[model samples]
Target: MKTTGSPAGTGETAGSEANGAGGAPLRLWGGRFAGGPAEALAKLSVSVHFDWRLAPYDLLASKAHARVLYRAELLDDAELAAMLGALDDVGADVAAGRFTATIEDEDVHTALERALVERLGTLGGKLRAGRSRNDQVATDLRLYLRAAVRQVAAVLTELSEALVDVAEEHVATPAPGMTHLQHAQPISFGHQILAHVHAFARDVDRLRDWDRRAAVCALGAGALAGSSLPLDPEGVAAELGFDRAFANSIDAVSDRDFAAEFLFAAAMIGVHLSRLGEEIVLWTSREFGWVELDDAFATGSSIMPQKKNPDVGELARGKSGRLIGALTGLLATLKGLPLAYDRDLQEDKEPVFDAVDTLLVVLPAVTGTVATMKVRTERVAAAAPDGFSLATDVAEYLVRRGVPFRSAHEAVGALVAWCVEHDADLGEVSDAQLAAINPAFTPDVRDVLSVAGALDARSAPGGTAPARVREQIANLRPTLAADHKWAVG
Candidate 1:
């Protein structure tokens, strides 16, 4: 990806316009406009600044769309050969930085089409014979987003694996788990890490679903209806690796619900990452001091020499706002549109583009943070004291000794009050204090209050016990491996 600010260059030229280092001049749409757009409006409206990322997907889609045109008998074998060659040349030029995309075209679609026409003459126009920019754009979006979601999924898997690695290393470490930002229970540190790993696994599933929905081909839906030509949309779909052709031309061009769903999925993933980022920032702070970020992933403040800021994490937490904005912007744009085709749909590309780019970068940085950080096991275990955390354990102990559950809960509640009045930890309460609340509280109740015993007793399929989490990790291996193959292949 290109840096945010760079010198502009002159390259692709259309009509009287000149290409800049940034991208092409507005020469692609020559048949319609007699006068050029105002310079400010041109700069403001040109998407070449961001849409360049779609160049590869656009070229691939063009090739598939062209072959479909050839099969429909609109073009001879020679014409098809020439168009394919020209498109290959275009793809290479774009990849090698030799092709300058002109701004005359509204987007990568027109820019590439115009370039094809320039190279292959009237034959290039034949590529669009049965395809409109409507279906064409939709097809390009699916192709691009499918690949992008896979990339994001791979990054998520890396992050998940990193969390799992951390969990494995800290399997015996203990910490306080909080609710409402106060200590609620003592949980294994490994268990907490696995919790996020599980959340991210579900996130991977959500992206996979989006990719499946976006995999349908929209190539033969010209304008608002089926084309008059005998186009083989399914053949194009197969060539482009789509699972199937779209069932309706009107729906194909009009529907952006796929894109909306993708944004929604990505937005939820971003929210999840943000929650994790917030915790990392909190844990690394001097007050908490439960973890230490490596110097490579941390930054020192300009004025505060002692400050080791979790900038990467804090920035990730902040970036969710951008993803949320993208989701909101796209939904708002689609909410009241009269479809089939509308210029309003043109606004769709930027947000989808931005959201994908943001997550691709953020996920990896988060993964790095997870992989390199040092967990302060001593501090974490030290903070895992028996207090309010044992209240439920005490209640359960009474229940096991034949007291009814509600009565046991009330008895534990009174014992907690006694401990609080005596300024004592639950573990420090005496046998006399135990009987004062309930005779069911025997000496073994003290053993039940230990964090290790509490974790072991909770063992079940999805429980926080070390053995249960190990089993959970074992099950994740084949599932994650299968998904990795699907994404990479």
Candidate 2:
């Protein structure tokens, strides 16, 4: 498709009115109309407030586009040099917070373009020769998310390392592992914490994988069809640190799958964090008494003197909903639209931005919580042996003694029922009671009934046995190091 110009002339003619002087329109497309947009419409349409955060990426895309224009012979060497110098000025101003978007500047693109023209006159206008806001914003968003993915990944790595540190401290500490909110078996607390670390590790993997797709540049996908000029999109992509350029102009500007994938990753992170948060909440309660929140990461009730609430965990839980909303909202906005760009697409950034901002705050706060909070080892150990937690070990012992698992399971179930009825623990059951349940009863059966014995019995790979946990911890150290390198870089 051919690029369209303003009704009065090229985009340059619309640039003056976009400067917020007199009663002129606030948009770059104002030249196509006789009058300005209504106040309500302008207010609703403007995105410079939230999108101004994308200015740096916008400037980066502009610089690369200037080089492309120069190669296309649309910009002479002097003009190119002047444009680059002017972009530097604009970037510096933005970096210093001296340059900002005015109400008339509808978005980051128009705002920065106006800043450029203000600095370099017509040379600034030449930067738009073969570009469109459609492709420009697409390119800018990709660059922004690419950097954000790395940043989020880095923070995730820190969280994973924090978990590893805590896990290392408790590799031999036994705790009651639960399923369906009931004690199922004994496990090392380290193994339990590493379960979360593994989930976060997958999150980092998703972010890295998503970056590969997000790396494709969208600059040369002018308005709709490819640019008419002999633009080198691949060269611009390389300059912008992308792996390649868009193969289809329409898809480049319109596809928001990368953003959706990012939100999904963010939401999954929230889900994982919320699970951690929930455990923190439970562990800190009088019921569990497994952990205590650090004062720095906790908050007090408004009127209660004895309340130190796990606010960080609670917020992480609440923000998971927000992250889910972001993904759902963006998907709704992108639903059923025809190929090519639309103003509805403008609705994409805010939700994803909120997701990123939410994660940035939540990750570090949760990390601090995990790092500083006291683990009530004595309490965890005490609770580990209560609630018939050793029942499973008895069943497993019978399995090793040649009893079929189903038979062993039935025997253990009966034993558990007998203990519950008698208000006694398996450790309290006598040899006669053991033999009454099964002929396999022997004095050695009591050996596997203790928490430590149960834990040691699970010495297989990925088990909660002390040796296995220590081995997993050692293996995780190098994995954390490798993930940290990729995340930070």
Candidate 3:
């Protein structure tokens, strides 16, 4: 732990000087260079500021690496014991904020190594004997992402449950279902809400799929090629909760596909969330007035006294772009690289890290927003009856009266045009007028065109009927509950 530098100061003056040996300087990667990095460059190039999030994963990987070395007989029992104990101490220090992470360490890996070497002397050097930063970082990223994916899935489950709760409350409430932004039919509000819950349910399942694929161990890949030492990668994998070890040593260190795959999953989840956010924004708008945001989730504009903007929803929508960009960035970074570890691969962590952070913030907040939201049932029902949402039912009634489907469609289409010209809803038309438009349109035509009748007629599975929506909600409850339990447990 000797250094050729001068004693460093602690204030403004210290900020410009090179760090000395005992001043909590970065001592991990300075072996080849005789001098320390410029203070400015050290502050700029180091990632310990943000990458400190990797500390737990780094310690976990180190313990597994230590066990591998011990099994390989590179360390005696005492050295193995000391390494394990020191690593545990390092983990504790990191967790308790007793650790000094300096700007010159470049990354969490270097900071951890420097701390370990300082704590345990030359015995710490034995930990890296058969591993390289290439494999080490790969292992750390996988471990970090594995835990992050699970956490995000947990948040997603909470969000899904929130939607399910809304569905449970609004199971009988009817709302206008739109296609091309035009009201197509009357659907239960519960069905509309559960549709998003299902989308997010698939998203949770996808994250689990990506996590499974991303959980392989690359610990002993060792810089690229197979290592000269007889290390058991499988043992490291087992220690780290990985189901398997990578078969190709070169690919193990070089592959960022798992990271990109995780980014892909994150991007898709973001898109689903953005869609949900968009609906919340729209439903709260003056035009729709179908839902009200809780005060805690709404923000007011400084100049506009009446503004209660859904800024969180807007931000969630904006963040989807960042997640999608991260996915694309990682894809481009890996596109033309040759097999086995490239410096370019170092750029991989930031994007996925940002995505995990964004989702963690967005998902839970979204869940809270959904959980406390107030659905405007009367407003929804008022809007539901006015938008020609029951036109399909009128067409169906004509079909039931022995008119051909195409003929019924034309008859209803002409009726809708007449109603539009007369500035009236289909329900405002008299039964005589309906029969005049098409003799197949009997007295039941007017009844069928009512919003409730429109919903009732469509009683098939996956339909918008209250009975069908309740069935769907009932079916979803146990499955989502099972998933939530599995994710948390």
TM-scores for candidates 1 onward, in order: 0.91, 0.95, 0.91
lDDT of 3 by residue, 399-471 (tens): 7778889998899899889899999888788888877887777776666767787788788878888888888
Better of 1 and 3 by lDDT: 3
Candidate 1 residue-wise lDDT at 467? 86
Task: Give the whole-model CA lDDT for all candidates, comma-separated.
Answer: 0.80, 0.86, 0.82
**What is the descending TM-score order?**
2, 3, 1
Which candidate's lDDT is highest? 2
For candidate 2, give the lDDT of residue 40.
98
List clash counts for every candidate, in order: 16, 0, 0
lDDT of 1 by residue, 1-489 (tens): 211111112132232222322434435444476566788977776776677778898899888877877777777787778777878888887888777665555577767766665565445556767778788788888888888888988888888888888998877787887789778777778888888887888888988877777888998888888888988988888989999999988999989998889888888888889989999999998878999999989899899889898988888888888998898999999999886888788788889988888998999899999999999999998887645786787788888888899998888888878888988888888888777777888888887888888777778777777788778778876777777777687
**Clashing residue pairs, backbone N/CA/C < 3 A, model 3:** none
